[model samples]
Target: AMAGLTTIRGLVPAIPHAPVAARMPSEITSREVLFVKSLDALQRRSQLSLRGSNLAAFAGRRTEDERSRLKRVRNKEDRKQAFKDFRAVATVVSALFAGLAVYLKYSDSELLYDFDITDDAVSIIAGLLFAISFQYSSPLQLLLVFFGKFETERPADWVAARIAGVDDPKAMTEYNAPAYAQVLSTALIGALGLVTASSLSKLGDTWSLSTAVGTAFLSFLYEVGRPKRLSSEEVVAREEQWSDFRQFAEARLVKAGSCHESEIFDAFVAAFPQYRDDTEGKAAFKQLRRFVYQWNPTAERTPYGFYKNVALSSTFEKGKTSALDS
Candidate 1:
């Protein structure tokens, strides 16, 4: 009987087993589904927040890079404009001096209005001579030639050394040439004017004090008004750069086997640090290496060889040519 009862109980479904409809929770009918939807919405919001942060970081980096590029371009333009402005001012001053010279030459009776000669004939001859000599080989032309020669034939190592503030006698010699030339030219011109005045006085022709004063003033103006005479601020800035260059050059010389190439490269690099990353620097360095190591046998020899050679050879050649012509 018990076995039969057990069988009947097994045939009955368990109390916990219910229809799917009856198993549904009252919470689903009330607010449980809404809570689940809210949870899904919160998860989506979190994902969007992370994506926004990443985008913002990317944008910030891009902005910084753009700012850096723009600043560099602006700085380059400013430097170019400054150089142009300086050149323009120099050109205007030169033009004014030239005009004064022309006026003086034209107004002088000896130059343009000789008493014995017809005005038109004398003026034409004087004008032609003046145009040929003074106009063609003017101060501006000389200045340009001087700088051109300096930039070309001048030893790059010498300039690099000067920029580095090297104290070697050779370096000083190289540095002083340009200044010497300027002073020499001024003195020579002044002397020529004086000689001309003396000759005129001997001929019983007097020149006004105003003319002499004007000649002196022109010489002074040309010397002082030159672009090479830097402003106080520019001098200070260059001196600071020179100090840095000297330090860097010294350090570099101590390295790289203490060779001349090393010294030259170090000086050049310090003078033009902006070129450190460029192919120009590499080429310069290579050339410097050849100059110091291959061309020069004695590294201890002063760097004044080229300058001395040019000065001596040119002087001798000029003397010989002058004698021959005479």
Candidate 2:
């Protein structure tokens, strides 16, 4: 009797998805049956995994996706190495300029008189160049890359991993600790540049202004030339994926007549489990919300905060009445 009861319980539908089963008419459509089955499968898989499941065979698909992502990251790293190489060159150049600044500060160089450039001017120029180059190849930036922080090429996956399964205090205070190294390194580098400029400057006071000027100028240039982070191919692929998602969402909304935010979010996550990452989930939600608003210029909100196209008002009303009846 207990074995029979256990079997019966196992066969019963989950509460969250029961409405679909209950609302089925005597002659149910194939699409409705498929949707119910998909929901059941997702629920079952979610019980097994901490992260929710999707409609597709997530295990196999995720493995394949991981391989593809690794390949892309490898390619990105190859491209990023070029920037690092440039920065390394900048580091060397900055060192050389620093040496020149020191040499001019000590030596009574006749060259400055020949060129009509005052020693103060030459010192400021060398210091400016050093500061600019150092911005690209700062000691702190190089060191942070080793620990995998504050890098343009660093993937979000690692940060997510670091904070995973930790309490709020541990997550903030331990895993996601403050960036003391960055601050210290920045201050040291700035001080070195200022001293180099001041020691070499005749006025001994202009280094402060010169370093600031260099920082502002280099920051502007860096901003202009900074990488977009996504490759051309990735950008195109992302657009295609989003297009596919938009189509799926539109079809699902039309089938349901209307949907609340949670329903839409669940539907999207069911279709694209890869976006389950916290940051990605937020982005996907924002995109989906924008799509919803754009789908119907005059959208109406149901009593339960569901959104529906005004054109589908009749269908939405019928669905709502049926749901309430069930």
Best model per TM-score: 2
> Predicted candidate 1: what Cα RMSD to the true structure?
24.2
lDDT of 1 by residue, 229-261 (tens): 233444464455455444544443321122223
Off by over 4 Å in 2: 1-85, 88-210, 213-228, 232-234, 249-259, 267-326
Model 2, residue pairs in steric clash: none
Clashes of 1: 0
- Evaluated against the true structure, the overall lDDT of model 1 is 0.41
Candidate 2 TM-score, true structure as reference:
0.35
**Top lDDT prediction, candidate number:** 2
For each candidate, what TM-score against the reference?
0.25, 0.35
Q: What residue pairs clash in candidate 1, if any at all?
A: none
